[model samples]
Target: MAINPDAVGTTGTPVESSWTSKDSLLYAVGIGAGTTDLAFTTENSMNIAQRAYPTQAVVLGDASGAFANIGTFNPAMLVHGEQAITLHRELPVQGSVVTTGEVTAVWDKGKGAVVEVTSRSVAPDGEPMFDKVMSVFIRGEGGFGGERGPSGSRSMPHEGSTPDLEVTLTTREDQALTYRLSGDRNPLHSDPSFAALAGFDRPILHGLCTYGFTGRALLQGLCEGDPARFRSMEGRFSSPVFPGESLTVRMWRDGAGAARFSTHGGDGRVVLDAGRVTFDPA
Candidate 1:
């Protein structure tokens, strides 16, 4: 399936959705937040304040339907390559939101097409809450002879002395099942048979789930467990993580209130790379 270059700039129908406190708590649990922090996973705790994980923006917008406009591409051959998210305001535990998105660019990569998508969500009051730019690679969907597209800025490796902090999260065996409740019902993360056909021993965890865990680590390690301070996060998916694996995220302070970090799976493979997180000092 060759990608249609014309699909670029195509906008999708806007979606209106709402979520509650329970929804936020469940998303926190799905990413293993409850293991070490009560603030994110538990509904109520004596010492910790309940809050929504920042990475939940990926679900709050839910722009998967918009991608269908880009022409036919094998679902099994698609993979998330990169993701960048910016938070304009702290996410509420319960609120109605309006999300709209558009295809930004499509580049031919010989064996595939790299599609870039940009989506934004606004609160019921029409104030921007968060925005995300995602890169998805569609395998065997290239060769239509299109432009190579824009190049991402180079991410600098971690510098300075030892890591300022580290956090480890252990995923549950059914982590993906719980994560799916957040709205992404991709078979690759749930259906064992579908996963097997996709060349996995069993269903794999959602890359975004790991992304959420990394975000949680950033919040805990540097942001004082405050969601309001989380400003932006960007990272590349380097490898897949199983549901039951433990991931360790090591962070190095990059600037005033920013850090460069990476998450390593239980097998010692870097699951996330070229990661950067920024937070408001105030």
Candidate 2:
């Protein structure tokens, strides 16, 4: 009930964030990358140059600071609703950035409220590096009679057509533990007792971890394994995925430089939907 609709347009002070080669390597392995993906998983693999994943931009900066202006709400009742990232250029193995975050929108959905936050990051030289948009749904924070907002259309694969690319990856049982080291350390992804208190039977995987995995598929499948060619990706979190689940990302080419995708968990349920990715086509 403390949700501040007026929080929209409020910006936070710029914060400097930095990361190292080891951080990038850890992120690659956290997202299920392995020896085969040497360029990302190793910094000194005999002639293999280290490169940060395009999606790693999401972790290089912290944007949650702007949430303070959004007013108080039960943290346990909040869940990631949607995520998006745009990379102006490929990330370096070690780099620093200054990020400024803002509250872009707040929508009332009757049963809950959805808040959209955006962060813009710039390299030390003042060059734009990446931008991130994150949406979170807070249960019981709605019904204030505010605007309902636009209900966007879903981006699904062409009817009855097979996916142009399908990459299935299995997450480790300790995936959340590794991903947590990057920045986010939410208890819902690690503490079973806390998860149960949040109505989950057990700990669940971080939505961003799933997003990182899906981004990997898009990079290899559409960008020819080149991070520089990967442009932007956006998707909604439709369901919860437990650790150790197999994720199958099915991508369908939409046009010359665009693709639509959905990720299904091992149970065949769509864990990520309305996915849209754009890259420099090979």
Candidate 3:
């Protein structure tokens, strides 16, 4: 099905999901967490300890079979295009949460529509903890009469310029499989036939799963495994990366401890761009 131009930008079919603690920890493990280096960290350990520690938390929960929901867009024609996240209360350190997801923006991108879905995770005490923005690209599903006025994009902080620091993360061939153990059962990353139907040579990993891995790397490289010091992170998905690919993140540090980050494939094809990460006072 194709997107209704008249339906773009207007909110429809909002989905609200309430989840338990086990589901929350499952997403953490889904991103490759049980090892000492990764699990020992505060967030990972906290997710693991939740069975023991038990607090309040929330994670990515979609309101619709989002990709399949677009009227004129086929699931095979969709791709992860971008991600933006903001944390309000350090992610609950551990339990149960009610998540509300909604379509916030629909941008016309020639033959595609950039659908931005925003999910808000609220704790049981009525406190909002984290917010996530996921952008999915629907190829050949644009031009729905939406205004395509003058618009551009953000430049990478370390692009064509010197970077303050650089970090490389190597993904294992079984990475996606391991990450899936967390909670995501999307066959796009599991079944070969499903992946082929989606036009991929093999199933590709979830972009948010990658985001979680990047979060682990960034926390280790910059935050020193301190979740308390993490403020926010934003990045654009430049391309899809296969499992077992080595990812190198380039960061640009600015005055007063601000920084920007981007990652590329081994061949140096940019897979993520226009990324920025901020931290709390040290």
- CA lDDT, every prediction? 0.86, 0.91, 0.65
lDDT tens digits, residue span 58-151, model 3: 1344445433334566766777777777777565434445566666667787877877777766676768767777777788878776765335
User: Cα miss at 64, model 2 (Å)?
Assistant: 2.1
Model 3 misplacement above 4 A? 5-29, 38-62, 65-72, 149-153, 197-199
Task: State which candidate, 1 or 2, has the greater TM-score.
Answer: 2
Clashing pairs in 2: none
Candidate 3 residue-wise lDDT at 238: 75
Q: Write the per-residue lDDT of candidate 2 for residues 1-282, one digit (tens) a residue.
A: 479999999998899989999999999988989988999998888988889899888788877789999999998788889999998888889989999999999999898999999999999899999999999999999998889897855647574589999999999999999999888898888999998987899899999999999999989899889998999999999999999999999999999999999999999999999999999877
Model 1 score (lDDT): 0.86
- Model 3 lDDT, residue 72, Cα: 61
TM-score of each: 0.92, 0.96, 0.80
Error of 2 at 155 (Å): 5.1
Write out the backbone clash pairs for model 1.
none
In angstroms, how far off is 156's CA in candidate 2? 1.6
